[model samples]
Target: MSNKILIVDEDSKIRKVARVYLEKEGYDVLSAENGVRALKEVCESEISLILIDVKIFTMNWIEACLKIRKNNVIPIIFMFNEIENINAVQVLPSVMGDYIKKPFNSEELIEIVKLRIKRYKISPSYQKLDKINIEIGSLTINRDTRQVFIANNTVRLTQKEFDILELLASNKGIVFSIEKIYEKIWGDVFFESDNTVMVHIRKIREKIEEEPENPRYIRTVWGVGYRI
Candidate 1:
């Protein structure tokens, strides 16, 4: 299943906290403050599921949901507050629920997101890639098999190495910071002293990259991070 989720909420604090939690579970999360930007994200990105606030003050999100339903069929989980009346969502067939109430716990949010993403995949209308593969130059990654091949020769990688590579390869242009990479792969908080991601990147380059010192597939952005 795709590990990309979008959180649509006007509250910056909510978005940040939810982002941190979801990233720990290896999800690449995108956020939008209101319906306009949220609709733009849904159109541009392959968002596996959407966690939208029931009350979007910036714009009418119910209208957004209706618009989304016209084209896409991804899971739409509502984040509602106790005081807000979510009766409008009743007409939305795509709404998984309005169960995520305000003052919600992170665990509940994560659980609901996971369940919806998994459950929605069961639909016959949802298209599944026959072969989940990523190819960059000579490097070919079969995500389903968790295998990497360099010009027909299988390249052996440690589990972490493969995870890092797949993370970068799957999101080609996006540069992930060392901290972000460490958290997503290790599923733990990264300390400043930790060079774990750097070490793993080196090992992956040695195996798949023709020249480890001057890598082709995984390029390091000076002082930023790595990207494919």
Candidate 2:
């Protein structure tokens, strides 16, 4: 069955456009004009993923995401028109599976949705691990619980960061190009922007590394991409 995606945005135009594109891609699309209605839909229906606008009436996207996370582990992508320092530093990490900056290509958005769904669809058994425990230096990843620990301190990672780390760590010594990483994690190679990957990588490094400038687990390959 096709995955069901719930879109929550204040703009009718964005909702209409996203619905059209996602429907064409064989997804079951549903939409709401604000967080209140979106939360209602989430409670009432079976949704595999969510695309949320950070600014909305009744409740903001962060609040909506917190509410959703309280009850569900469904993947959520947060959309913003501009990336303010406060939003990037505080708001985005709290409530999103991924953040898509606005003026985005429709095709890229569709691909990201597909990638998130694909990740969700993968069963635990498909993961490459001797058991559920994954150790890299002082960092330990518990696959079953989706928890990460770094030298006795529990490192908090958003879902997307964890996925990126897992993908790199799983295939150690392999140089994953930006295009390859986008396709593997976000599900679309069409919108392989360096900034998008950079933001995610920076965030991940901040959480897991002692010094993000000189990282241990995830490392940059210069002209290539990232490796663990």
lDDT of each: 0.79, 0.75
Clashing pairs in 1: none
Stretches > 4 Å off in candidate 2: 57-61, 85-94, 123-228
Clash counts per candidate, in order, are 0, 0
What's every prediction's RMSD, in angstroms?
15.0, 19.8
TM-score of each: 0.54, 0.49
Candidate 2 has its poorest 10 consecutive residues by lDDT at: 123-132
lDDT tens digits, residues 1-228, model 1? 335788988899889988898999888899999888988877655567888787773336666677767665688777877644576555565644536886678799888888887776776545443236676776778776687877645688999999999999999999999999999999999999999999999999899878899999999998899999
* Candidate 1 residue runs with Cα over 4 Å from true position: 57-60, 94-98, 128-228
lDDT of 2 by residue, 1-228 (tens): 246799888788989888888888887788998777887777655577998776662346456667767654688887888766225535345465777777578778988988887776673532433266676777777676677777534677898888888888878889898788777888865464457777899999999989999998898999988898
Instruction: Give the best candidate by lDDT.
Output: 1
